[model samples]
Target: MIRKSRVVLLVLAAVAAGVLLTAGFNVSPIARALLGDKEKPALIPAAAGLRMVPVDIPQLFKEVSPAVVNISTTQLMKFNHPQMRNPFGRQDPFDEFFNNFFGRMPKEQKRRSLGSGFIVSPDGYILTNNHVVEKADEVTVTLLDKEEFKAKVVGTDPKIDIALIKIETKKKLAYVALGDSDKLEVGEWVVAIGNPFGLGHTVTAGIVGAKGRIIGSGPYDDFIQTDASINPGNSGGPLFNLKGDVVGINTAIIQGGQGIGFATPIQLAKSVLDQLKDKGKVTRGWLGVYIQALTPETAESLGISGRRGALVSDVTSGGPAEKAGIRSGDVIVRFNGKEIGDEHELPQAVASTKPGKTVEVRLLRGGKETTVAVTIAEMGGELGKPAGGHDLSKNLGLTVQEITPEIAQRFDIENTKGVIVSGVEDGSPAEDAGFNVGDIIRQIDRRPVSNIAEFTKSAAKFKAGKTTLFLVERGEARILLTVKNK
Candidate 1:
């Protein structure tokens, strides 16, 4: 009976102790006594070593926003109807009647637009997008202190959509330093300061979503993608890094897309900034060679080892490439000591090179590697044109013509060896096979076709409903296409 009573007391004591521990009673001393706690080892948080230092964005904006400016432009647009004519000049009877009835359509209209810019110099040199003041007759810049100034268009490069404008001001102005955009990593914090929707000096923060993004804006399509809220007036605004340096220019946004924006890397702008400031235009170097991506299939067909370089489709006659002895089917692996990774990289590198400067071009020809010295030329004027011809294959929808001296001079073609494609019937087999007007037919089924007679003879042997290989020169590039004979 005594033993049973002692067991009941011990059970009741355990229940009471548990209730006391659950009801906010101190139990650490009791645990320490049982667990032999050595100064109670400090508890470590899960994210103790992985915490990121928060960026002081407010302080960053305070230092950079003064340089940001609001840009407004006015353009005069003229409207002319097909039948509308000057009342003082001779007019058709029907045109005169239409004008008299319509009371002379509104002669002109004024277009106004708003954009953003940033001062890059204390002397008031501002950088903005070329499209902002492209055809603007009057440009006004408003500063952070509500001061306004008439800005002059210093220079513009429409290809890359960059403009340098100057505001004549003696007052001290804050300027943002240009940062190395190439060093900017993806996921780094960035801030965009602009006048979105004409709302003055709006700031948005986001991380660099990606770099080297191609959105088909132009030939130089390298853009930095961000999730920052960029709107219409944000065009030409400065995208600043954490160090208060301008790293990118907020340029474009996707319509109906949330949090998708694009900025032009400041590195590209810096490349032409001096030229834009001095020459009032950007002069890009030209290589005068048509190039295509070296795909695996193309490499295998060319007997090349790997697709690591740009494949030369065609070399322009009398141009830099032809003068340098670069031929069609050559793969350019290196240019001016810089390794060419792909076809896209070659154009950018060549364009960035100074015109009239000689550069070394390393290429592979027929499984042999060789280097050639070529002088770069200024990019301008139309490269080539099509020749007049007669229909050679109605079923194939191809028109061929022999290259005559008259035709060569008329079309500005230096080499007159291959037959030119004059036309391709729409929706025909040849058109579907990618045959275009102005294509020079060089070979059919591995047989050379130098003229109309050769082309007709080669094309006549094509079997109906059989696919035939064709090699053609188009726009300084040679390409192989397959056409299923109809």
Candidate 2:
């Protein structure tokens, strides 16, 4: 009987709250005027008898909503492709029919996602997320007063996922000031205003969850994480400080989780924005080498304890690194003016540099620290493909077989198809053909050859002085390729 009474009292309390919230409660005269005397009732601010100098969200909204414009984009996508697939995992048969009639041409997919952005300049420059305007054939920006205008993408950086766009509003547009995102403390209050889940201009409140979080969005993943209930369609919106300055750009989230969301710190976005506003594209420095992060064993080999810095795995001939005297097995400790902490940091540092600018690169080679001056080149522009590598077994001679479960069942061998060196006698061609123990011959003359008879037939088909393509399936997808006198 006591439990029943408590439940009834709780229900009564909830009903009273609903009535008080919707009973024209906590509304100022100006709010009533703007809303045309229409009763929203649910818009009752939490504190009816609020403190004199409390956080005035509605006033903040009035100033912010003008700069917080809605962005909608459309792009052409290949019909039946991943981008054009229906949200429910079904495609309209009509869509496929249109594709067949139009050849391989892409179908127009109106991926209408709503996001929030803010104007940065009086000249109609706007900043948003790369995901908002990237690959967009058309973008439309709607202002607070319901004024809609067409927008053009100025530039975009996929690495940081920030984009710059422009529109000719023809009037002095409202804008926001950029605050130092690096100065934000973990417990500082931040507000997120966005079109989350298609509910336009929704506001959520939370504090900075953490800083310098690496969510693996890109090579440079130092994001400012927050707990402000951001959902889909909030990408590219501004995360604001209580002072109403744009501090961060809301970027990503972990799905099916609570109290976990992330935003790109505005400091990085400012760099990208400045570049895009001045130049149509960003130019980055290029190094002609592939690098691998060092493992503990590799760190020991490199004479380092913690295995820091990037280890050069390969050098491109005539490339910037090679020409600058950079070589494989060297660890890059610094680039330009910044100290490289690890392999991942190197890319971001290089990408920030201007093309054609000669920069100092520090490296450790042969246990000796050295510095080399490398002239930066424009990244990814007209670079030719490198030649294929050499194979020793093919240069002399080799024969092997692919060890398989079925073959293992037949040949009574312990392992999979390894090249079985056949006919290796004293001073014989097989002996000359670099044959080794348990070598599996998976290919001959560019074709796969299994078993002794198949190997013999394939070897006979190859003419001397001609290159034979041998697809030797070695252990675990490893290929033992050889080129030798046919």
Winner by lDDT: 1
In terms of lDDT, model 1 sits at 0.84
Query: All candidates: CA RMSD in angstroms?
Result: 10.1, 16.4
Which candidate should be chosen as best, given TM-score against the real structure? Answer: 1
Summarize candidate 1's per-residue lDDT along 1-486 as a digit string, tens digits: 999999999999998887568444454543443444434221222256542332356777888899999999999999877764467666668786877888656889899999999999999999999999999999999999999999999999988899999999778789999999999999887889999999899999888999988888887888999987899999999998877889999999999999999999999999999999998999999888877777665565566798788887666667888888887778999999999988878888898999999999999877789999999998886654222117469879888888889878887776687798888888888898788888877777656777777888887788887777677876545776767787
* Deviating ranges (above 4 Å) for candidate 1: 1-55, 80-105, 382-433, 437-440, 443-448, 456-486
Q: Which residue pairs clash within candidate 1?
A: 313-478, 314-477
lDDT for position 71 in model 2: 86
Per-prediction TM-score to the true structure, in the order listed? 0.76, 0.62
Q: Each model's C-alpha lDDT? A: 0.84, 0.70
